[model samples]
Target: MRMGGLTVWFWALASASALLLGPVVSSSSTTWVADGTVLELDDSNFESAISSLDLVLVDFHAPWCGHCKRLAPQLDAAAPMLAALKNPIVIAKVNADKYSSLRDKYGVDGFPTLKLFIHGVPQDYKGPRNADLLVRYLKKFAAPDVTVLDSDSAVADFVEAAGTFFPIYIGFGLEESVVSKLALKYKRKAWFSVVKDVSEDVMMLYDFDKVPALVSLHPSYNEQHVFYGPFEEEFLEDFIKQSLLPLAMPINYDTLKSLDDDERKLVLTIVEDEDDEKSKNLIKILKSAASANRDLIFGYVGLKQWEDFADTFGANKKTKLPKMVVWDRTEEYFRVNGSETIGEEDQASQVSQFLEGYKEGRTIKERVGGSLSLTSFISSFLGLGTVYVLVFVVATIILVRKATEEEPLRVGRGDEVDRATSSISEAESREAGEKED
Candidate 1:
């Protein structure tokens, strides 16, 4: 009996020792501990850091990149604010230039590439770069999928807290269950809330006339859309999808990619400059048109901001300013026969006419390569300079063929060849003058 008791005591002592030392061993192995500072990571610890954290924002950047240098201060300032939240999000970075394998693995093509990792899943970060904006943007990921608002003040507070980055959806006189699934479905794209107790003033504020209404607000654009219906899953989803983007969206590389799943044709407006007063006025007119025509996407791009992209639409320094076209967001685009350009005078009327002509099928279909064209593929593989050279060669060949076909009998005569070349140059100049006019 004495021997058996001693054996049991020894086993008990061993169990106590393990209980005391197990946590220390685990803590020593943990290389990443969330303490409110930006963590510098490399290949050795990058996987372990991201895999252990629930949410992480990784900046793949190079030391010599000017933009990366500018962004470092912002991340440093926002790290502590984010880490103080109930659900902390780790801010981390990897020197992509030094770590070539890590850079290629994540497809880090540009400097200061921000990517958010949620439960080990990677997504491109498209939010603002400012310190305060970064904090507000990252907080969304840490927040609840569906926030509950009881009073009018809570609703206002929720809207204020959501900021102007993502669309806000508030469900009034509706059960949380109705939008819970949708909130989870589009948690990354929008902010969802349920207002249990609503006031008459609140209803009037949101411009909703009836109960069981879903008010979707694009605060950045000062636009609101209300849906009052059976609230079936399909109908609700349709409304949510439509409210994801504002009426007048600025066309850029990122915004273009965001429209991949949207089936609507884009009524693209190319302007001299998007930030100028004239362009701003044109955008207002386009937004008014967009309000009436929700089936189409109204977008505007600036010639100076993205000349290369505008070149794809036949818009260049020589072409008339404020040109309009209907693009299918792919290979084919449609140009209205009569309303091709919006004049400075009677601009609203011109836009209306363009829309009417487009709807009446008074359009000419033209094929053009988009971002996924062979030219872009070559540019990506062999650099943009090569694409420019290829385009120049093709244009020269076409011009030569036209000149030869026009004067076949004078091909052997040097004087005739010189005259043909002069004629071709004059024709090109005239074409450019016509485009300018």
Candidate 2:
């Protein structure tokens, strides 16, 4: 049975190749046709062959399709195997560009549309043009039942009926970040009715340091939210509500800012030993909490391989190791010794209490008063103004003194004539007076 099945399969493939290659042209005693040959189908012989065949496999192809080029050789190899089939199928070719009418008639939009026709009736086929897939489709449905439609028109028709609710979520590689899991969870909840490839575009847009970047788009609006680590279920639920639904609580940061009497709370905690596992875990939890909620400002000073990370938190030789500080824009401050073992829950609770009391007091800087001290500012301004005034006064005095200095006069022809005339007049007067005497 297996041998018989193999024989049938081989025969089917050969038939497919012969039909796919081109129409067979007969020459002599053995009736040699152009089987297993990739050739052109022109207007001259097309019509008569279409009239003769019960099943005509017309490949509407272009030279540019890589898949079509690949399909050509495979079609050639299958030609001889096809000759053994009881009811033989013939291969034909149509260059869609040259035969524009044929393409227009079939409504062919994309290249290499394979159409199987029987008795001039069209039926069912859609594709990526894989030969094996095509063979299976033919075997299951038979050649006559499959119809070919124009790629563009067929896509348009399907899209119209495809339905609403398109949701697209984009994320980074799962191995790179924990955010990938959150992104996938969101994708499943939203429904895969609509999906898009946003990998390249999102990576550039966000200047994303890391991913999984989750972006969801609906008919009404689009939402993008980013997560870096393990996200709590409740927090994620709230995020979706805030992002998608209009009636949702504003995220925690907004609520903190709205308080009329908000104080900047600062807390400091010190850990004695740097190499302790408890200290590292506490730091991790604190950082995670700070990342998730901006309610309390958290800073860490570590002394475990402390030299390596010392530069990161601005810690130096003078500063003590295993120190944690909580600072609110600067009204209230608290310090704790880090030589102790403090769990994540304890740290969270302590920080939360500190902020609550701190905000109630409102000892922090107000917008107007926080800029600078009035006395210092005035003194600084006056000092600069005094320096400028002295500079101007010195420049003016020098300019006046320079202007008052004597300047040498140039001897011109007019001055010479005046001097000479006065001298002559005096001499004449003296001579006249002497004569009168």
Candidate 3:
């Protein structure tokens, strides 16, 4: 998934790789500093510090935020180790609450927002929060954009050192110059390596039969796609873009935001619970469909896991579970005319029919969160603010009506309306409280 232009996948991949390959070791021969300190910055020095550094990871945080407080010591612990790199990444933080103008300039909407600045250009830091993982993640930035693999051992070592956090592209029997430009272009997204020496075992391992093959490996997903390319800039870039996402992604806030770069609409499956046996079986079916229909992104969300988010797609406790829809990831979605729900029997056939119907335009288009406005789009996140605004508007209307009334209102009807509004307000308040917790 792409997080602020930096594509990331499951962190579980990194954890598993650590277990199998052990800790990552730097190959730099230069002597490094053993002690380094995190820099404290404010509006006065923030610009100067970022502009002067080749690489800087800045934390925009509020002092009182619980998450920010927890992250402080981790950054402190990581500072010295990160500073010891050949191309050291300086760690810094600003009290965003105290410097509201600086916070607004950087568009820091939430506490503990970490941004990595590469020569003053900022990209969001969405990697691990733990000290060791953070240090390992930052080390990737300092490595060469494209590494040349000379031997079988080098290939094995490169893959092992890469871990599973980023996708790896190894060009077999291809020139370094051919992929050098792309390697630089997508440096933040994936690792690129050109293998000059090709072996039979390496060929079998990567599952490619020919030379001039570019293999894209998502180690996290244990998935790989081979491109026997014309290798032109456009075609190569297209392959790289498509390779960024997995075949079947689980829907959540981070994954949803990742779709911003991909133009393909989502084939979203909504289930009662995503972790259950039935959902797992259905995901296998979805993955099969995804392999064939690469133009559409296949994703699944559990209603039980994220009720508020699922409700945006017209799902609720009363709605039938395991529903499918084609979502544009914005305000509108499409529902197949007759195949709104998926059945337990012949599930694969049902999915095939739904896709066929959608492609044939035998579906109903519907808008989500009312009219297409920025406010409505933003309200789709949680929607508690929208609820409060609606409640206030209704209360204002009732007050205006009562003040303008010249005669006594009907007592029973007035009490019923008051009770109804009160109940709605109370229920919304409770929900908002729960969300804060």
How high a TM-score does candidate 1 get? 0.73
Measured by TM-score, the strongest candidate is 3
lDDT, candidate 3, 220-269, per-residue tens: 88889999998998999888887888888888755665666679999999
> Model 1 over residues 1-437: C-alpha lDDT tens digits?
32333333232222212001111112235656567788899988888777777788999987766678889999999988887777788899999867867876776545677899987789878788999999998888888889998998899899999998889999998899999999998988899999888899998999998898999999988999999977999999988987788999988756765676689999999999999999999999999898788889999999988776777787888889899999986557999999878899999999999999999999999876543355553333333234444555454455455543432211212222343234334334555666679
Count of backbone clashes, every candidate in sequence? 0, 21, 0
For model 3, where is the 10-residue window of minimal lDDT? 4-13
Report the lDDT tens digits of candidate 2 across residue range 386-425: 2223344443454355544232111112222232233233
Q: Would you estimate the TM-scores of all the predictions?
A: 0.73, 0.25, 0.76
Question: Model 2: which ten-residue window has the lowest total lDDT?
Answer: 245-254
Report lDDT per candidate. 0.76, 0.39, 0.74
Model 3 TM-score on a 0 to 1 scale: 0.76
- Consecutive 10-residue window with the lowest summed lDDT within model 1: 16-25
Global CA lDDT computed for model 2: 0.39
Clashes of 1: 0
Model 3: lDDT to the true structure: 0.74
- Distance (Å) between predicted and true CA of 343, model 1? 4.7
Better of 1 and 3 by lDDT: 1
